[model samples]
Target: MRLLAVLDRVDTAPFTLEALAGLLNRLGPAQSRILHVAPSRDPDYLSPDEGMPDAAEHARFEHTVSAQTDTLRQIAQEWTQAVIPHRDTAWTERVGDTRTLVAREAAGADITVLSRPSPQDNAAVAEAFAGALYDAGAAVLIAPLEHYATLGLRPVVAWHPSHTLDLALQAARPILERASHVTFVIGENAPMEVPDPPLGAELARQGVAVHMDRFLLDTGDIGEQVRQHALSAGGDLLVMGAYTRPHFIEWLFGGPTQDILAHGTLPILTRHAPLVRL
Candidate 1:
């Protein structure tokens, strides 16, 4: 499997980098593509509405960006070596409006990995992650800030029999098929007995040893519910479908996906595609 791991600054210095390295180990020798998106000079970057200065400022900024890309390329190689040691990897840099590029590039990726976005995170990182998750046409795994030695070793699936869950399960098969222990936490939306063949049967067909339980308390607090259940069940990773409502709607009222991203204690695997977010 291959992953498009987008870096906000491509600097592998933070706990974010360490966390990514840990998640990479969990995937078991997969190819990695590193895409760096940031202003070359600083953490803060001005968007178009913020206004730009003269031609000199523009040229200088472009040069700085080019220089940073070179630096990031070197860093990508060095970090991957120190982290994964012997994994196939490639590196690239993106500047300016990268939404379309991220979507196109992530089309063939099994998963698009990004550092979990925080309220304090740069606006650029938030924009990139939003675009990637909404448009990548694949699952996106938001890596936590804490470094983990391994992920997906013991996994919990927050499941409800639906198209979204099916897509999520399909995307997570690589991890599911390899998990030592797998638990399925049936969310509030799930019927007592799935109408069609149970999801557990499908997972069984894929050779996943699994069990299920009900998750009904604190239904509004999806993140806590998933977190408590998974950790209690000894899971290292949490798998669930991505944003189902329009991104604007979710951002406005917040949703389960948003709650999980904000407070969940584990790495989250989410799948959404071709979002028509307004």
Candidate 2:
């Protein structure tokens, strides 16, 4: 599989660069495109009525952009030099609207990796993430500030009834097949028919260690519940569907996917928007 690991910003956790490279190596031998994207230059990004930055602000921003671009280049070059003689590993800095660049770059990628939204994220950071899910035409593997474990080791799948869930499972099949253990966290409202095809049986046929159980999620605190449950279960990765319906639905009522995105700690593997078939 060809993977696109987008380091949407350079100013995340300091060790994030290392963590990103570690994950690249962890995804077996898949060809990877590592992109460290520059912040957007769109004047209307934050506010529609806002005009272009004044000369002073523009100068400062340009300086910051130059520095960030250098940092990204250095990090990628150093890592590339260290891993000399490797094939199918490319890294570069992309400058444009974060949303448009990420979406366009993710077109044929088998999966895209990105950092989780931090509490300190500004508007651009948040929008880039949402764009990766909604416009990438691929699945996303969300990474935390720190590396917890490999991509699929002891994976925890949040199961429900939807085409979204099915797509998530299929996209995650490669990782699931290599998992040390797999736990199916079924929500209370989850359809009983989800197990009709017997998801466990399907995985078990491929020799994956699988187990299933129901989780009573406190509707208001679903994020907290998911985190606690995954931690208690010794989960290293949390897999689930991204905003399954139209993005508008998630904006209106919110959903487990958004909640988990907001609060989840484990590396999450999920797919949504223009769902890509695996």
Candidate 3:
């Protein structure tokens, strides 16, 4: 898969490089591009009635932004070689909104990889990048700061009888094919009509050691149970379909898939259902 990784000047963490390397290694010799996006420094005005900044302040902000961009280029150069070992990998720099830039660049690529933002920067560039790519119909991989390569190929698939689950499996087919073991976790009280047995068998046919387990949660904390199962199974990556309903729709009608997304801590590989069929 052709993958594009967006790096922002403000988000400089060592784990970002490690995550890129891991993703490239997992994807084999696919074409990968590292793009550095310069963060805008202009203070956004809340309304038209708000006064503009003085000329001196605006010039200072512009100068600061230029300096930051230069620093970003240097950082990108250092991080690119460290993260992407292959000589064929290409790097570029762009000046614009990171979210918009990534969405445009990821259009033709099969997948996009993004590092999770630091807790202090929860609503930071990473979230914007993820939302933009996902909204653009690209498969996204969100990597945590922890060293994930040491976790090995054993993975846990959080399964539900939904199209999103199928999409996640399809997007993670490469990993699943190479995984030593795959554990499917399902709700104990879920309806018997759930058709995951065939899916499990299919994975087994692809050389993955597959097993299914059911969990009963009295506290109704299914998210906690899923996380526990993955950890107990020694999973390196957690595969799940991302729930993509409108905020209002989900608020009134609860979604276990959304709950899992909110609580999952492992590197999550997700694809929207409609994209999966493609």
Candidate 4:
């Protein structure tokens, strides 16, 4: 498998890279590339009419790039040897727009791995996360800010019937196949529009142990409920679709994706923008 790990800023938690290495180990032998993109210019750093930064401004940008590059190299080197020995891993940094560069790199990778965005994340980290999932049309694994015990061992699904969910399942097939058991947190109040080939039966055919946890979704924050269920069920990872609603609508009235991103406790594997699949 090909894994792309995107780190957009120097101050990002070191545990994020360590989590990627740990995930690489879980996936077995795989080619992993760690990419860090230094912003060419910060927001409103200079106006377009300026035509380029003055000498001092250019020097500052260069300094920031150098620091970012050094940080990535050190983290990748130390963790590759300490955590994922014998794994094929490479690291590099470039100067460009974070979103565009991340999307370009993620398009060719089987799964893009990155730190989960917190409310405190700066513009770049959030943009990188958005790029990998929405712009690149790729599956993403979001690592927690702290260390995790396992990934893909026991996965909990936030079940729903939608094209985005279908794409998420397709992208997460590899991890699902490796899970010891899978749990589906289904909403009793929601429609059960099973596809032509039922997802549960298909997994059962593959010899996977499956269980369903049905709940009433009539009250409370659904996202919070999903997260609490996963934690109580001892789920190491949460599998689900992302951004089911339009961005503006989601922002206006927060949805599951926003809630999970803000308060989820476990690692997450998800995809976005259903119609566009890679």
- Best prediction by lDDT: 4
TM-score of 4: 0.86
lDDT of 3 by residue, 1-278 (tens): 77766665345434555555666666677887776665453534435676676789788877976786677667667766655455366777776566577777777677666666443443236434554345566676666656666332777888876777776677677777777888887766655545675767888988779988677655767777888888888887887766665331242126655455445667767666433443
Runs of candidate 4 with Cα error greater than 4 angstroms are 10-13, 46-57, 190-197, 244-254, 274-278
lDDT scores of the candidates, listed in order: 0.68, 0.67, 0.65, 0.74
Clashing pairs in model 3? none
Tens-place lDDT per residue, model 4, 1-278, is: 88888876555546567656666756777788888888878554647775767798788768876786787788777767776366657886777888899989999998888876655556777678767877788888887776676777888888877676777788778778877888888766655543323677678789888878776776777887888888877888888877655442343136655667677778888887645448
- Candidate 1 has a TM-score of 0.79
Q: Write the per-residue lDDT of candidate 2 for residues 70-124, one digit (tens) a residue.
A: 8767766666666523545687577777777877777678777776665565556
Candidate 4 global CA lDDT score: 0.74
- What's the CA error at residue 220 for candidate 4, in Å? 1.4
lDDT of 2: 0.67
For lDDT, candidate 2 versus 4, the one ahead is 4
Clash tally, candidates in order: 0, 0, 0, 0
Output the TM-score of candidate 2. Answer: 0.81
Candidate 3, after superposition: displacement of residue 85 in Å?
Answer: 5.0
In model 3, state the lDDT of residue 196. Answer: 72
Q: Against the hidden reference, what TM-scores do the models get?
A: 0.79, 0.81, 0.80, 0.86
Candidate 3 wrong stretches, greater than 4 Å: 9-13, 39-43, 83-87, 118-127, 150-152, 190-193, 245-263, 273-278
Clashing pairs in 2: none
lDDT of 1: 0.68
**At residue 112, what lDDT does model 2 achieve?**
75
Task: Kindly report which residue stretches of model 2 are placed more than 4 angstroms away from their true locations once superposed.
Answer: 13-26, 39-48, 81-88, 189-197, 217-220, 245-255, 275-278
